[model samples]
Each structure stands twice: as C-alpha cells, then as structure tokens.
Target: MTDQFDEDTGDYPLVMPGPLWKRFKQTLADFVLLLVNKCKSSYVFDQRLMDGVIQLLTGLADSQVRAFRHTSTFIAMKLSSALVDVAFGVGGSESKEYKT
Candidate 1:
C-alpha cells in the first residue's frame, strides 16, 4: 500500500489490487487494528502507516472480490472505527492531501 503512495499528491493510486493481495491486506489491517487497540498512542505519530491503513480500509471496503463479503464488511467496520480513534489520537492533524 505504501508502495503505491503518490508523493506529489500524497494519495494512493486508484487501482484494484490483485487477488492475492486481498489476504495480505486483510491480515495487515487486522494486525494494525490490533496494535492500535492495544497501544493506542504508539501509532499516531507514524503518519505514513496511518495513511496506508486508511487507504487499505477504503480499498477493501470498495472491493468486489465476492469471496469474503461478510468478512470484508466486518473488517471494514472495525478498521473504520479504529481510524476514527487514530484520527482523534493525532488531533486530526491529517492534511487535506492525505484525505484524498
């Protein structure tokens, strides 16, 4: 995810990830949310990681893989919720560029 970041725009490329990427993304999101839940303050300072997680959530939520509809939906909700907390953790300092 971070590899796809556009330095000029500070946004990820709008492209559908590969099939194998689905599991990798899901696992990473799960781990990220777990870490955020356990150590709320530890991740807020890593803006790049936060940016990737947000991008990951958006991608997974928008995916049309059709293999794990329920699971994807559930994880999306969890990630979205964790993101809200992360946003507050940073005092919502995320720049407009990152939001796109």
Candidate 2:
C-alpha cells in the first residue's frame, strides 16, 4: 500500500502561497497614500483626521508584528510631533490675524 497526495485536488507541497514580504510592502505603500491624501484634503485642525491616521498606522503595525512593530513606533511618534507643530502654527497665525 502507498500513500498518495494529489497535486491538483488535494493538499500539495508545490502550491505557492502569497508572499508575506509583498503584503507588508503593499501595506506600507498604502499607508503613504493615505497620508498624502489626508494632508491634501484639509487645512483644519480636526481631531478626527489625526485619529484616523494613527488608527491606520496602528492597524498596519498589528498586521505584521515582527517586521513593522518597531518601525511603526518611530513613525507614529514623528507623525504625532509633526501634527502638533502644524496645529500650533496654524492656531497661532489665526489668532494673530484676528487681533490685527
């Protein structure tokens, strides 16, 4: 008697699954697109916009624990700081204009 594994219909060793690296790269690229789109669409200091960006990055980080967790930490901190700077500058300028 011999064991048989069908390549076409049953479990097979030759079948190629999706590559993890490609998926990770795609997620990173999509994050860049989301960031660009968000920046281009608004000039207001809306909290929801910042929350959405953070959530998107966090979700990507969660999806690939080993490859992106550390990198995401750095990215999140830098982005948050940049957002704060922009918000402060805009608010300060707006208040000055009102005073003038």
Q: Which stretches of candidate 2 lie over 4 Å from their true place?
A: 1-52
lDDT of each: 0.59, 0.55
- Looking at candidate 2, the ten consecutive residues that score lowest on lDDT are 1-10
The sequence of per-residue lDDT tens digits that candidate 1 reaches over residues 17-62 is 7666666666767775887777666664578876786676567556
Residue pairs clashing in model 1 are none
Question: Mind giving the per-residue lDDT tens digits that candidate 2 earns over 1-100?
Answer: 0124222342221122467655654565556545644673373245787677678779756643433444566467656655666667678989999999
Candidate 1 ranges beyond 4 A from true positions: 1-33, 68-70, 83-100
Evaluated with TM-score, which candidate comes out highest?
2
Measured on C-alpha atoms, candidate 1 has an lDDT of 0.59
